[model samples]
Target: MRNEKKKSFYQEFEVFSKRTATSPFQHQFCLLAPNEEVAMVMAQENFMRREPVADIWVVNRKHIRTLHPEEKRMLARIDNKDYRTTKGYGYLRKKWRQYEQKMLDEKEILSWGGDKK
Candidate 1:
């Protein structure tokens, strides 16, 4: 062993991957390396050794910007906005029953536009 001082080469990195083009990116795992390029290479062998990988991303933990709790509170949304969801339209179901008509929700309506095959 050489009697020399060693630098802190390993840094924290977060990894994300996706299996297909239409799939959303999901968190895989983290790795430690000297830089992002090396981290990516290391992640391929460690995380995706068996499965297929469409995309890969390695983000340095230090470079990631995050908001504080107060900032997150500022972005909080209330559930009172019934008009944004199906809750506001729920009354129509009872009205349809009164008229002896079937009520169609989002899924039923969307099924009409599905592939013909």
Candidate 2:
């Protein structure tokens, strides 16, 4: 049938793009296309018209491997990441004070050139 043939012609694709070179690629949207070439063109025309796009990637949905909700529970828990944060090094403030030196916090680092201290 004509409907069945049309359905077979199109496949689902996941679109990802980034606005800047240093930024991570983020998912834009999903679309149906006959092939990767058409998917790229379609994405370019549809999304590129809205805002700036640094890079674009079109991937077939079938090609991507993802973990199901139940499988996610089997993954290791890594919530303890305070060591990577400024607050985790709070003890350093006391150490620096002993030497009469200031320990620059996040607030001071961010406000470097805004106002004169």
Who wins the lDDT comparison?
A: 2
lDDT against the true structure, per candidate, is: 0.82, 0.91
What stretches of model 2 exceed 4 Å from their correct place?
68-70, 76-117
Query: Candidate 1: where are CA atoms >4 Å away?
Result: 1-8, 101-117
If scored against the real structure, what TM-score would every candidate get? Answer: 0.67, 0.60
Considering every candidate listed, which one attains the maximal TM-score?
A: 1
lDDT of 2 by residue, 1-117 (tens): 999998899999999999988999999999999999999999999999999989999999999999998999889666888889899999988887765544355557777768765
- Against the true structure, candidate 1 has what lDDT? 0.82
Q: Mind giving the per-residue lDDT tens digits that candidate 1 earns over 73-112?
A: 9887865787888888999888878665444455578788
